[model samples]
Target: MQIVVKDLAFGRINMSIEKDIQQQTFRNSYQKATVNIIFSANWLTEQIKIFLDEEHITPQQYNILRILRGSMKPLSTLQIRERMLDKMSDTSRIVDRLVLKELVEKKLSTADK
Candidate 1:
């Protein structure tokens, strides 16, 4: 009757797909795998959000920063979006926010213009 979620901060590492979702059984391995992937993704996103929250940035913004840092060169917003973990993210808006926060700088691309 108790709901349990994996919380690394409290030293709780054990997690089971069946127990986590309160589903005693799955229809098949494919279904189980799908559900597990979704559940794990959501859990991971939550964890990332917690960390990002501490840094006062959204996941999208964090994704952009990571991409830019790894690229070691300027990338257009389109390029940033293409490399984003969440394709649905509004890359321009996130980049703008980052610019306002002074975490990232935006420059006009002469090549594009």
Candidate 2:
């Protein structure tokens, strides 16, 4: 036996993402998968935004901070940019903001010379 959902109760949105988007059907399996990936990415982004909002940081800054933390040692801006989620992000600007917030410190490395 199989069942199909035609419509879902609006009140159940918290439990049903399909209802939230008012979309439950796809033209093909690939379409469904693509939608799922996009939806998941969006959900993850929103959750991250909410988590960082309390700390007054943008995703780029948070990414840099996380990268620095995991590095266990200070990294150059190029290194930070290489590990960032947005490869095109301006790592130097993000680090500057973080420094102003006292969430990060930037120091010059003479060895790089």
Candidate 3:
């Protein structure tokens, strides 16, 4: 799904459309689907960001925490970094922020036989 908005002197108008269509002709008839989807996704992302921003955390940090919590076992920085959707270049830094939030911890495990 996607939405498009245009600003006017008086106000703004928005339009939305789903991606699926019956045929190429139908798709062509709707010229704004791609643009609408891009705008909608961006708008939704920004709204979510506003919520996370209140906690002084970035969107990537929130995702990392969720991945760690889902693991239920200790994960190495590399492991967590590999699984992240955004795949940030600095996984250690992201981990540090989560550690500061007390939502995650780093510890060494005993070697197994």
Candidate 1 C-alpha lDDT tens digits along 1-113: 11123344534755789888999998999999999999988888788788778778887887788888888679999999899999999999999999898888898999997
Displacement of residue 25 (Cα, Å) in model 3 is 16
lDDT of candidate 3 at residue 63, scale 0 to 100: 77
Of 1 and 3, the candidate ahead on lDDT is 1
Off by over 4 Å in 1: 1-10, 110-113
Q: Could you tell me how far off, in angstroms, the CA of residue 85 lies in candidate 3 after the best superposition?
A: 0.8
lDDT of each: 0.83, 0.75, 0.67
What TM-score does each of the candidates earn? 0.74, 0.76, 0.68
lDDT for 38 (candidate 3): 67
Best by lDDT: 1
lDDT of 2 by residue, 8-107 (tens): 2223225454665798887888887787778867876777677678668898877787787778678998888888889989888888988898888778
Off by over 4 Å in 2: 1-17
Number of the top-ranking candidate, with TM-score as the measure: 2
lDDT of 1 at 10: 30
Residue pairs with backbone overlap in model 2: none
* Candidate order by decreasing lDDT: 1, 2, 3
Candidate 2 vs. truth: CA RMSD?
11.1
Candidate 3 whole-model C-alpha lDDT, 0 to 1: 0.67
The window of 10 residues in a row where model 1 has the poorest summed lDDT is 1-10
